[model samples]
Target: MNTSSEPGDSLEKQAGISLREARQTQLLKVFLVMSVIYTLYLAKTLFIPLVFSAFVALLLSPLVALGRKIYIPRTISAFVLIGLLIAPFSFLGVELVKPAERWMETLPKISAQITEQINEISEKFEQEQNQAEIQAEAERKQKEAEEASFFDNWFKDDEPEAKVEEVKEVKENVVTGQIKQGSIEIFLSLLASAPFLIAQMFGSVILILFLLIFGPVLFKIFIQDFPVVVDKERTVQLVGQIQKRLSNYIITISMINGLLGIATATAFYFLGVEDAILWGALVGMLNFVPYLGGLISCTILLMVGVVQYGLVSAAFLPPAVFLGINILESQFITPAVLGQSFRLNPLIIILWLAVMGWLWGVIGVLLAVPILVCIKIILEHLDVLPHWVKLLESEG
Candidate 1:
């Protein structure tokens, strides 16, 4: 009886120890993951351009490879490709300048119109209020006005005209000083950031060019290091699949956005909307942010419609049409083109977008889906985390 009891006690002790160790290991992993996320957040400036360059290189690599087949130098081909990529955007920017300026100039008018409409609505609603309520509101306003007037009289000078002029001068000086100080602060901030911005831009370009030049050779070097033949082949296949999917997704999405922009511009122009190109460009760019982006674009279009066409049946048409086009694109065109490979769970995508957008702002939002696609491809190929893959996949 004593010997049997000893053996059972020993077995129970061993099991408890093992369970404790497993819990510790899980906690350690959680700590390490938190640390890594913090590090990424701190070092985003360095990493943002690096990640952007990697994606751009992935997108442009096939063209560079084709150039190599024709005996064109990678450097030349890269430069030409970058130039071609920037040209359309540069043209769009140039075309947007006048419209943007006009919009800025008309903003005051828009504000006034909006205010007028609001006042009109308020007046109409005011008529619906009972006489007692209206009288009470009027009395309240009169009391406040009388209190304000008392304060003004208490501070009044004997010569009212001179006092008013002096007050105006003082207010003007205060306003001018604030504007000047704000302008200076803004200028200084931009001045300080200019170098970093320029360096980041140049660095991204150089990185893209280097990647384009040496990407194939680098792949070869990477696979050469695998110890076993099976591992080597797996790595090669994995990298190939990731590259193919990423490049195709980027290229396909870009073409879709370009077409959407063109269609939007044409539709807006025919709708007699001013600054059609600007709105079109904005819609295309913001569409990158998935669900949130479309909502924002619709809201902006709605505002433009209200401001440009006033509160009429015509005002609602622009956003309604925009919503329709976006629905058609998102529902039909994207599904047909991308198919199932790049499809991710909607919840997972939203969470990832929120996390990344918090971490890296707009660029992070744009890169989020591509990064998820890369992760999905790797996980599927490695077969290590089937549950994670399931969570990521759109399948129920």
Candidate 2:
């Protein structure tokens, strides 16, 4: 009887320790996860490329599969497709360069126009203010005699000329040469990283070629062995769905921008805005980045508007037009085409663009939405995350 009680107590003690140990083990795993997450944050430069490449792969997979369906060799199809895509891009590249060339030839003219417009607007404002001031001055003179009696008595009480001397001493003091300095270090840093743009473009083109050529092989390797408890078929299905959805997204967005560019360029040309084609192309391209794009377009329009229309309403017109088109796209076209399920929350999308812009700049902003879309899809399918949570995180 004593032996039986002692044995049971010993077993209970071991089991209690095992529970505590299990808890400690789980905590250790959580700590490791947190460390890894922080490490990724710190090492984002390297990681951004991987993320970009993965999303790019997801985008291009559909086209690759289409090529396969049509019985074209992967390498040939990739080359042909890329070549076709490159034509418009190459045209755009040419357009970007054209502004620089024209600037060289017409710098003096542009400077003169900008100066003339600024002076004209300033003078107009000054004239209006002067007219109002004259009217006020006349009014003040009529009232001055009435108001001066009390002041005059007060001034006589002080000394007759004391007030005049005080008035004479109150001269305006203007500060000169108060130039705020900008950091050469930051300027040089920006200059140094300018190469990254070229590197990114080259890297992307190469990545495209590489994926197109070896995508199937790479896909197999990537998913062949996994650490998680997901099924292989499910993995492939997710990838396929992601790929199809993303590629269509890329294609659709690209087309929308292209059409918008053409429409805007035509409008600009009709409005007699200089470099209409260039501005239009920029409007189309930059608008892909969301909030910032509209801002940039508006700024450019305001500058050109001052010269073109010279009216205050004219100054507001371009931005308002941009806002209107955006409203249309957001309300009707985008929802109908991209569908509600595929859309992203505006605030999250904007924040994503800003983060990416900070990390990799404009290029990153361009990719941010796509990368977020892919991540949202993966999170949506995960059972660990609830349906409501996924819906909130998703395009919904």
Candidate 3:
């Protein structure tokens, strides 16, 4: 009995040790993850431009290769492609400035007008409610009188306490003033940060040009240091697959978003929405961010519609049309075009977007999906991290 009990105790102690070891391993993993995230947040200014350049390089690498097949030098092809990419954006930026400024100047007035319209609707609703309540009260009193015995009537209090409701007033002028002040502050802050932002943009463009021209050569050199022929071949194949998957994803999504924007602008223009082109460009840019982007675009459209149409039934048309187009694009067009090539768990995508957004900002939110695609491609090609692949994969 003593020997059997000793063996059982030893088994229990071994189990306890294994549990402790597992807990330690998990803690280490958590710490490593936290450290990486903190580092990313700390170095965002440098990483943001670097990551953007790398992804852009991957996207344009195919075009550059095509140019090489035609005997165009990489440098010249890179410059030409970059110029083509920047031209339309620059034109759009120039075209949008006046409209953007006009809208900014009128924002306070728009806010006040929308508020006033809401107040009017609220007042009408309240009046109808008050009339219904009065009618119900009168009927209730009459029924009570009909049912009351003389003794009950004599026992009842002659007068009951009256309940008074406080009516809150919305001060449109005060709201407008606050909005105007806040806008002014925001504009000044943006003006102050313009130089830094421009510098980062310039750095990104230069880095992209360099990466587009020399990226392949650098990758080959890195692979050569692997020593074994099999390792070199595997590394090259891995890089190639990542580039292919990312390039296709970016190019297809960009085209889709561009078409979406064009459709949005055309619809808004026909609907007599002011600054239709600006809103179109905005929707296109914002669509890069999944989930949050469409919600924000719809909200802005709703407000703009209300302000423009002044609470009329037709006021919902702008956002309704925008929502319809978005539903078609996301649910129908995207699936048919992209299929499962870049699919990931929606939960994983949202979590990654949140992490990246917290670490960086709006640019991080835009880059999150592309980065995730690259990661998914890499993981699929490698045997390590099989569990991660399972975690990231979408369910059937």
Clash pairs (backbone) in predicted model 1: none
- TM-scores, each model vs. reference: 0.80, 0.68, 0.82
> Between 2 and 3, whose TM-score is larger?
3
Instruction: Give candidate 1's TM-score.
Output: 0.80
**Model 3: per-residue lDDT, tens digit, 92-178?**
999999998888777767766766777678768876776677677767766887898877767755321132123334344566578
Per-residue alpha-carbon lDDT of candidate 1 for residues 1-396, written as tens digits (9 for 90 to 100): 998799899999999999999999999999999999998899999899989999999889889989999999988998899899879778988999798767755555565566566556665664455344656756766677677777765763344345545665576556556655665565567568879887988899888888988877877876796455457876777877888888888889988887887888899999899888899898998887788888999998998988878888788988998898899999999989999977788788889999999998777998888888888888888888999888898563
1 against 3, candidate with superior lDDT: 3
Predicted model with the maximum lDDT: 3
Please provide the root mean square deviation of candidate 3 (C-alpha atoms, Å): 5.9
1 versus 3: better TM-score goes to? 3
* Per-model root-mean-square deviation over C-alphas: 6.6, 7.5, 5.9
Tens-place lDDT digits, model 2, residues 8-122: 9999999999999999999999999889767766777666666666666666666777888989888887787678767978987886787746544443454455555555666
Question: How much is the lDDT of residue 157 in candidate 1?
Answer: 36
